[model samples]
Target: MGKKGILLVNLGTPDSPEVSDVRRYLDEFLMDERVIDINAFQRTLLVKGIIVPFRSPKTSKLYKEIWDENGSPLLYFSKIQAAMVQEKLGDEYQVELAMRYQNPSIASGLDRLKAGLVESIQVIPLFPQYASASTGSVIQKVMELVGKWQTVPPISFINSFHDNELMIDTFAENAQKYQPESYDQILFSFHGLPERQLKKCDHTGQHCLKKDDCCSTLTDVNKFCYSAQCHDTARLIAKKLNIPAEKYSVCFQSRLGKEPWVQPYTSDVLKALAEKGKKRLLVFCPAFVADCLETLYEVSVEYHEEFRALGGEEVQLVASLNDDPKFIDALVAMVKN
Candidate 1:
């Protein structure tokens, strides 16, 4: 076999934090049938007419707040990750990075691998959990692009590493940097998905959102369930941190539209904690590997203010595993294996 190839893909960032750039990014991202889970006409109407026009400017401002001097924290760290993985793997394997939506697109990354005429390619979507909107989208996009290739190589996907020991350890390690015990509560917040999306994946038809504890444990039926995987990720990280189940709570953030999303919502959790006089909270967003607008601005800044107004002392966000050496090691092992 010829040299193997590794492609590390993450959810994209806007070319710039400008409203125009953000609008374009939103159009591409929110318009995806996998993302909005609606017909093109409806999705386009909702995204273009309602979401992009109103949300872009506001979101662009938030993006600017978190935008590092180098660039987007997500893209910057991803570049570092790809470079480090390449160095670790040495000349035996070629490593490339792509953002699923924007700059350094999957098409460009795949083209590079095709130029090398690699024997096989391992495409690792950076999402820890397998959401159709995230990991599934990346896989679908890669297949669509690679399908047209005259000499398509063998390809494999690392779909989900939510419970990978090293990954869990890295998140635990990041949390340990701060005083985990100093906070009143440790909130494990994952990105929210619509309830309908979760049910769509329920092959058992009665598993998702049916029982309260259905997502508490990972079963073969809910193995690919995003909510279940998020809970599992939280459980593993909390276990590593020696956090008692009662002391910490699992919640979801970034709910869109009026339709119910996977609950308990992070905002609701914060409000409840504040009402109960649980101040000085710590939050962990395990769904995201790198600090982006959601983590840096939304959780760190926006949520902080929300909790403060509700009579909480502080809502400290744990830094994500952005270009961390341990995280790169975990990625290296995942790819090389």
Candidate 2:
């Protein structure tokens, strides 16, 4: 009988929250063509000369705020999710965990699968939504590595599972657990990508929505469009909770560089709400299945403080969908398909 296996991959974290470790992680992360999407020489200068040198110290400080005794929340939570999925899937399909960058690299994970003599491999990139930078990068990396092998197992990829029922249910469950006293506003913040990237989807500007009705409407392309899907997630969750559409907003966060990224920027939205005298806020980051730098430090701490500074009375960040049993069931179902 042919061996079947599953490999889970996530955007990784630093080995430690220290400045040095964070710098190393950033170097690997930002250097990626998908992440930076620039020429090699230019990417190097930006990553090493600029980002690693400057951003690392600041990011290291931020990581310290969220880092636990175990380590980076992203890495720790990912491990938990992987183990839970493994347990649920049983022993028949060996499961291995990997990160796109840093330790437990994709190369290493594939090596383990090869050593196990698995006949078929299933790759699950942990990003719930598809983006050229996230899910696309993983597929690119897998193909590059497997292409080098003289003999390779048949591979299948679970691309975007954003609207999976179990996933949506898990998110709803977490939001319910928080039980906000009565939020005047709910914000769904997703990581930002450059507008140039979004335009790349349809350069003619005919197929692209540019954050208009086309994106808001249910369509085949919008089904996989990260920005549209984020809005859809907010709508679904709001429908489940019976929240009014006027009470919620969908925004983007973690924007890098000066390039225009998909917006209603999260920071700008926070400031606007505060200015409008909307004090109570509940923010949810459904883009990230696990709490990472973006959700943990960037949204929970940084954005929370921003809201308060803008005279907001309260800002609560809903937790991520990490190792929640329903979410694990979603993963199993996703792979089973």
Candidate 3:
């Protein structure tokens, strides 16, 4: 009877777009067993010796391109989202924002809720699709911290909202509003994860389908399968918009390292579309509900240029859900449920 709290979680960003800041952030992010999922020694070497040292400078440069007056897009938008959700939820539920990594950590968010003497807490991870690296890590971290608490409050974790009716409606409505003209091709590009990491959760093969029936069919496993859920979201959104199946393609982007991640890579698909004579393309990045480096820089700018260079024209990148009223309404419905 004290208070009810809501913790809004998102994948974090570096404190600054400098190499040093990026390295530090990567050290914490990649060190997560859920993120890299390797043994300690191997994880340390891979993250520090290889990834942090090399990828940091490059990623920092990319961050610089997207850095705003406020700060990194992820942090800025997350703060806004937290404030908005708090305002919407009103005094009944104390809302706090936490980044899975970096400042305003999940532990701190939980601590704030505890300080408020909250009776129940809803932990909503701001990911449209579930990934062991993203949603799983948030869940693991929250459970780890809450486990050490003397009196744990009732908690509910909203894993993914891929097929939420409101979510689909929001995305469909946005697409309609932005690109009213019929698009020759619709591309749904999601953030990529290594295939090995995905197979790790393929227990019973019922949910996974291991490249066969897994994602193609909807089952309990598809609920947790990042690839499957992303595609399903695209399909559902397309259905809502009455888009033809053949006119759309689902692909993955922002792959790091040499390891094979999800396939039909976005770049390759773009080239293929250009060669296949699909001139006008409309792209969507549903993986990220908000516009970040991946959506803004990688897809909108980079891929837009790529398509043009390859003889395509009018490559329009649809905006992310980012605090859209419908999206906000969806979040409210999700939490209330």
How many clashing residue pairs appear in each of the predictions shown? 0, 0, 1
- Model 1 residue runs over 4 Å out of place are none
lDDT of 1 by residue, 1-337 (tens): 6779899999999999999999999989998889999888988889989999999999999888988789899999889999999998998898999999988999999999888878899999999999999999999999999999888888999989999898899889888878798889999999999999999999879889998888999999999999999999999999999999988999999999999999999999999999999989989999998889899988999899999999988999999989888898999999867
What C-alpha lDDT values do all the predictions have? 0.92, 0.85, 0.86
lDDT of 2 by residue, 1-337 (tens): 6567889999988888899998999998888898888899999888899888999999899888888887888888889988998889887777899999998899999998999898899999998778888999999999999999999879999878777777877777788876743788889888898876666655456666444666675476556667776777778877777778888898999889897898889999999999999998888898888988888778777888889999998778888998688899898888788
Which stretches of candidate 3 lie above 4 Å from their native place? 206-213
Query: CA shift at 203, candidate 3, in angstroms?
Result: 0.8
RMSD for each of the candidates = 0.9, 1.6, 1.6
TM-score against native, each model: 0.98, 0.96, 0.95
Arrange candidates by TM-score, highest first: which order?
1, 2, 3
Clashing pairs in 3: 209-214
Instruction: Rank the candidate models, highest lDDT first.
Output: 1, 3, 2
Which segments of candidate 2 are over 4 A away from where they belong? 209-211
Top TM-score model: 1
Candidate 1 or 2, higher lDDT? 1
The residue-by-residue lDDT of candidate 3 on 287-316, one tens digit each, is: 887789998789878898899999998678
